[model samples]
Target: MTPLSRTCRRLQDSLNSFSNTFIFIFTTSHVRTSLTPTSSTPNSLLNAALITTYPPLKLQNRKPFEAQIDDSLEQPKPIEETAFDALKPTRLPSNVPLYSMGSSSSPSHTIPVVSTFANPFETSNSIDASSSIRKPISLWPGMYHSPVTNALWEARSSTFERLLDPPLDAPPQSELLTKTPLQSRTSVLYNFSTDYILREQYRDPWNEFRIGKLLEDLDALAGTISVKHCTDDDNMTRPVLLVTASVDKMVLKKPIRVDIDLKIVGAVIWVGRSSIEIQIEVTQSTEESSDTSDEIALTANFTFVARDYKTGKSAPVNRISPETDKEKLLWEEADERNKHRKRKRECKREVENGKVDDRLEALLAEGRVFCDMPTLANRDSILSRDTRLENSLICQPQQRNIHGRIFGGWLMNRAFELAFSTAYAFAGAVPYFLEVDHVDFLRPVDVGGFLRLKSSVLYTELENPQKPLINIEVVAHIMRPELRSSEVSNTFYFTFTIRPEAMKDGLKIRNVVPATEEEALHILERMDA
Candidate 1:
């Protein structure tokens, strides 16, 4: 054999051995491996490409890449927390019976067993034995109690529960047949000056107190006062059930500031056999002084009706006796209001029956004249339709009260917001809340129902050149599309005015005129109110 032939054989053998080693290492390891030319390998393989292999990368307990990307994109934004969130019940009581509208009668139910005066702000560990034994806090003649929880919302619910289950140990009906107005008098103080957290709850964006919140508290307070008058004992375990029927008027006499302390005093001014008339006054301490001499900021009147808890029939309430001259005057005023309400109801029924009174007929005539002649003098008069605004939403369970009905306060807040918007749009300036003339809850709203609020500038008073008053009416309806039914749930009347500062640019507010006879009648009704 030749020497050159032997060397060629040796080179071929070396190349074959190197290739086998590279393949073995690549297949055996679970990680990436690369085979490059080394000093022991042939020089011809130095410039050749390197052999490399990589195993598939795996992550423990992870979603697919596409799924991860989708999840990141679909994540919801965080919601902001508000002070009112605490007012919501953490969980509903399992024992409370749910009322069904379709049912012939309410199912027999019992009140849940719980503390009568549990302080929601205190935890179990913080509540001492002495505190638990303390006398029930009395707001007035009849102290309010809650079964499930002690939140203000629950306190309101206690009154509703009484409508279904009255206390069995109530006093005899003949014992406390009469109650003085002073006996039902009560006052609640909201010390915003020291309680920063409470102030935030009632404060608006402009640092002023929210009148909508005030309206809610006022309704609750009035209901409490009514219960106080009807029940003779402080325990409030009476066989009478009282609920708010209507709010006659709520007038804002002055602007309310959130920085100062506020006080609400209310009493049962008068009572019928089954109805109660309450007067609530809101006052605020003067910012300049530390004394208790507060000035009146607002006044409201509410009417409530009582019913027998078990029979669900009209129940008589204790008669209110007037002692002081002030009390006598209030009683007289309430009597007049009651008479006026009856007359108004009759007039409404007559109009609904297509019988228009002479006053309403005259107003309709004026509306026709305004519509027929749109001359230069009356050019600023716009039709009510042109000054209208509306919004709608589905009522949610979160908006429900303890009785499973939509809360009255929630309705008032929504109506006021829509009215404010209507006034702002009509005036071409930011409108300031002046007063809530009247609110009527004709029917209760249900959860999951479609609610629509329609607001319009009912009329305008340009008596003052600097500031013009805009009267807005908001009508809320529960629309059931499936049933092809739309029912009016509430009617709200609010008055707003453009501040002099907002009208400094010489913006003139156009007068609102009714376009139809119905609208004309509504205008006249408000005028009378």
Candidate 2:
């Protein structure tokens, strides 16, 4: 139908047959000019200026106007603006301007003025997202295009699957301070080869039997082993030694097939070797290379022990904590009293912005924190008491100044011996370790630092789970995600007091009892705030 709609239905059927033969010759020239009073019709003002210069047309093609443009090109609906078309001219384009064409002009009238100021099958010069003559489709009808369509009114029905923005309900991230210090503190190490040689004994893949090939890492994976080098034959001696040093291959792009074949059993030997002798232990995980088959009820044997170079015989070694002097005088008084501190402190209020701890200097300079944590259990009990103090004893290296790097109070006293073994199996017997108060340094824990202290006792009072109020949280972390120097965050409070049947008969006590009325209204609202 569109050849300007079949030339507007052949100019509305030739203007309805020339308006019925010009209204029967103007009703016989108005009955012969009213019977001759003034017989004038010659060119009546050039036929009334050619019938007021053509505008009105189309008097009949209802229904089949190509079925209303085939249902407007099949479902292109949503252009509804009925307040009677919002009183027209809101930049007109839902295919507008089809006014009521019903009168004059006819050489098969086709007037399609769809110009992007002048388009013609678009593309190369792009302009046609419904180009109503390059915008400004209408304004002067009675003037009020809603303040110019309210600036193209974007009520945002947004798309492309909501394009990922709705995640900011804000408030769960903060604490990443820096009056200027998140860059430049480099120290990284993972060195390995120094002619690496461990020998309890397993030695057959000398490059898979010296150049025989099955070695692109146990290739299509199949394991059959037998190795040598422990001539006192602890029955073929192979405790374990996987020394793959073929080098340079970690640049993969596709088709990686690693069907697994590592069953190492431990033998990184050598009791002595110095002059910069390496000691790398990055067993990325066989559960740190040993408990892969996980069967741990209690397995705490962390002994490094390595001192016999000349036999003044020492042993214990799990080092990791190296610099201190009160952390170089607390970074020289934090660089001379906040060395001109002005990193982020002008928030002059009015930032309802993203909420997580409410702009605490931009949520600790963006660590994004939000913590409400503190509910583990309340009455049924289980608070932490830990025992077996003897099988796990027999130490020899006690040089204790432990100063620098490893002291968040010695990793919170070895994480309070792992929460005293679950508060001594929930105080069915003995639990007493009182008073550890509100300590919140908030940040600044360093020196080759390493930390893990997670204690939980969400509720209990006098009825003893050891007089509870233990909510210890110390997560000092660092995994070299580009090393974060001296990371620290603290929030601690401990108030323990438990003595279940005092280890059965020894006489003990407990405290903190507000059993209820909502824990005495939360201990009288923490003693009135």
Candidate 3:
């Protein structure tokens, strides 16, 4: 349990660290709010508290929000004699102009003539005199809010708000006009606290999930990531994947979330007993083969795993940060080789604007091992750069088959010789024949013609660690010396797995790289390709 907790914390720490990175920045304002995550697995974000001060409003050099009743008392109203409807002020009733007349009754009672400014007899729309009433203060809600003050002080505050220059809020305006940097800041903060969760939390769904559907996982579909925790036989229960991250460190307060992509090629699943032997007519809608260009199907075996998926609480999974060195190298090599195919010699040539693209240098440098392939006469036409091992031999005349064409064995023997020449060096110790996988003859060979063979190491399994078994890909191509430039007579793959324990104990392992994803998938343990 502690181990899992540790894993969760670690993942959270990583997420937090990555979130702060410029590239992984939080770009939205909504993500910027303060959030407290309680757990790494299914991290729970808590509500945030906001802090703000009441705003002040000013009108006519006076703070309109000032505590007072003068605006209400001063508000003007006409004596309603006729029962007629009137349009009320759109703004708050208090905003209506107010008129102050001498408390004493004016002579206007003598016939009571309405003043032009405050007509007592006028209806709401009769150029009402009350409309002319003026307040010592003015208020604009768009600019400010209620303020605490006396009438005189409020008036002064309102006056101040009116004088506030537009440039005072220029900075906030510019921010909205462009991008709101606050959003990015918030996103980074959130991810910074949540990254660690992805690691172990991802394992639980699979851990609790039952592979109820056959061939479903085979379809390589993404499984449901969210699932309920299940009780185990031991009374322990699974937990959700949650994580947190700090600056550079990821801490998992709960489980971590992790996702991986895996591709399977040439898989053979449905294994069973005699009655279990499942066989079905599989129609491989095959494509027409091209005779002019060499056609070949590539195959591989692969596996996906998380070095550590330990998750729990109190204490979490013990991390192997330093222990990943070897794994890192192995995956790096496998991935790099898997992505690239043999490069054509023509690809190296350039005639752009009479100037070569210097950037090509980077490509060559990355594929340093591949760039120095030996150039043959028809270099760019048919032979591959990696086919050198098989290409060296020029097929010589052999007793022809019944029809007088050379026997295929003669060319096959040449391929064997080419493979043995380089492979024999490592066979000084123990040589284990792991397999002689599917071998195909693309075409027939004629007598007295040159045959080229190329061989490369695809993968090696060091079961004992001290001694390794090598899987060599020996590809042999047959070509005619008479018309070698225009024709390739035959091609085939001869796969051999040999262990080097019998070799000189002191010799170091070199030139042996790990299998590619495409190549490894073909050599998966005991599963024939």
Whole-model lDDT values for every prediction: 0.68, 0.26, 0.29
lDDT of 3 by residue, 75-101 (tens): 656677444322232222333222212
lDDT ranking from best candidate downward: 1, 3, 2
Count of clashing residue pairs in every prediction: 0, 25, 102
- The TM-score that candidate 1 achieves is 0.65
lDDT tens digits, residues 93-209, model 2? 223223332333111333445533333334556433233345221111101111111121111112101211222233211221121111111111111122123111112322211
Deviation from native of the Cα of residue 72 in model 1, angstroms: 24
The digit string of per-residue lDDT tens for model 1 on 182-203 reads 8878778887889898788887
Q: What is the lDDT of residue 22 in candidate 2?
A: 39
List TM-scores for all candidates, in order: 0.65, 0.16, 0.24
Q: Among all windows of ten consecutive residues in candidate 1, which has the lowest summed lDDT? A: 63-72
lDDT accuracy of residue 151 in candidate 2:
21
Model 1 residue runs over 4 Å out of place are: 1-176, 232-238, 287-294, 346-379
**Best first by TM-score, ranked:** 1, 3, 2
User: 1 or 2, which is superior by TM-score?
Assistant: 1
- The ten-residue window of minimal lDDT in model 3 covers 222-231
Q: What's the lDDT for candidate 3?
A: 0.29
